[model samples]
Target chain A: DTAVSQTPKYLVTQMGNDKSIKCEQNLGHDTMYWYKQDSKKFLKIMFSYNNKELIINETVPNRFSPKSPDKAHLNLHINSLELGDSAVYFCASSPVTGGANTEAFFGQGTRLTVV
Target chain B: LAKTTQPISMDSYEGQEVNITCSHNNIATNDYITWYQQFPSQGPRFIIQGYKTKVTNEVASLFIPADRKSSTLSLPRVSLSDTAVYYCLVARSNDYKLSFGAGTTVTVRA
Candidate 1:
């Protein structure tokens, strides 16, 4: 079984169209995150949810929103897609403790292309 | 939050050792250094984590100086399959956002 999985591994749409990417993890992690990797292979944090609560929100535009129904799933929705939105979006999860360190596991990215 | 800096790419050969260094000048006291590996068309995988000195595991080893300003990931006898992008990150226990920089892309050749 895939520890972390994302649906529609690839998405290609036109400009101004809205789209969504779904992510789920079976790792029993309390914190889930969404990261974007641009063409230069730079990974940037977009948002994070700890037990379904929004914990980290980067300086991303309002068009990108992350919704976590539960601790295991975090979905990202993008509105009014632009050419600049073309990149690979990845979902990740990590077990958090009150004062301990842990690592995050990422899912196969969803490559979104806006033309 | 500690911002990290690392090389964009590196080259290595089979059966050779590879070391990638990451710098975080403003690391916090409770921050831990972590490294992740990513292959083409796939997400990143956790390789190792360390706080200071040295920490070795089955796949790799992490070496950190006393200052904790930088860390190095050492791979022994790397193979062609070891060619991947390696990301260095520094985060505290309470931090939620993991700022992944343009990781060092290790290319292991024959």
Candidate 2:
């Protein structure tokens, strides 16, 4: 089984539309994170959820929202998408109480395209 | 999250040992240095991590000095598959912020 998986490996929509990307982890991790990779291929942290608590949030747009129903899942919802929003979004997870196993496992990624 | 400085790009030959060094001058005392490898269209994968001294895995090795100002990731017997973007990051034990920079893109030639 894949440790971390993302639904809708690719997405395409027009500008001003709303879309959502789903992520899940079966590795029993307590913390989940969202990262966006732009055209420059720089992976920037968008949000982090530790046991349903938002701990790390970067200077992202208000149209983007992250919802974590539980530790295993973290969903990202985008409203009024723009052409600049087209990029690859990745989901990662790690154990909060772990020390040696602190490496984050990343999902396949969702390539969002806004025309 | 501590800022890291590394080469923007590097080139190596197959079967050669590739060493990529990352500098984190203002790294915190509790922060650990880690390296990740990313392919063209895939997410980054953990390579190695160390607080200080040396740490080695089956795939790579991490070397950090006592001052902890910088670290080096050494990959032995590189191949074409080893060519990828290598990112260096510094974070606390429990920190969740992983700020990835424009990592050093390593291209291995045959």
Candidate 3:
């Protein structure tokens, strides 16, 4: 079974269009995250939710919003997307232990193209 | 979050062992070093993690010195299929905010 999965493996939309990507994890982890990978292949964390509570919010534009209905799911919605929004989005989850940092499991990722 | 520095790219041959080093001079006592591998068009996958000394897993091994300023990820007998970008990260134990720098791109040639 796939531990982490994201829907709409590919998305192509015009400028100013809005889109949403859905993510789900079956690992029963308490923390979920959304990361954006640009064409340069630099991965940057955009948002993080711990047990449905917002914990980390980067300097991402307000057009992007993350909603977690529960600890198992975190969805990202982008409003009025622009040309610069074209990139790959990844969903990841990890179990939070009080000790050393834990390993994270990432989904296959969704490639979004804004024309 | 501690900043990590790694090689921009490296080339290797099949049947050779490849080792990529990452430097995190400002790492704190509560931070841990982790390595991740990412193939083209796919998300990054966790390979190994360690607090100090050495950690060996099925796919790779991680070595950290006593000062915790640097870590090295070693891949044994790499194949062409092993070509991927390797990332080194340092974060606190309970911190879910992971900062990933430009990873070292390993291109294994046959």
Candidate 2 wrong stretches, greater than 4 Å: A97-100
List per-prediction Cα lDDT, in the order shown: 0.91, 0.91, 0.93
- DockQ, candidate 1, comes to 0.62
lDDT of 2 by residue, A22-111 (tens): 999999999999999999998999999999889888988889999999889999999999999999999999885223456988999999
Docking class of 3: medium
Off by over 4 Å in 3: A97-101
Give the candidates in order of DockQ, highest first. 3, 1, 2
For each candidate, report its DockQ versus the true two-chain complex. 0.62, 0.56, 0.66
lDDT of 1 by residue, A1-115 (tens): 9999998899999999999999999999999999999998888889989999998898999999889988899999999999999999999999982224668889999999999
**Per-prediction backbone clash count:** 0, 0, 0
Candidate 3 residue lDDT tens string, B73-108: 999999999999999999886676888999999999
lDDT of 3 by residue, A22-66 (tens): 999999999999999999999999998999998889999999999
Q: Give the CAPRI class of candidate 2.
A: medium
Kindly indicate the candidate among 1 and 3 with the higher DockQ. Answer: 3
* Interface RMSD per candidate: 2.2, 2.3, 2.0
**Candidate 1 lDDT over residue span B1-68, tens digit each:** 78899999999999999999999999988888888999999999989998889999999999999999
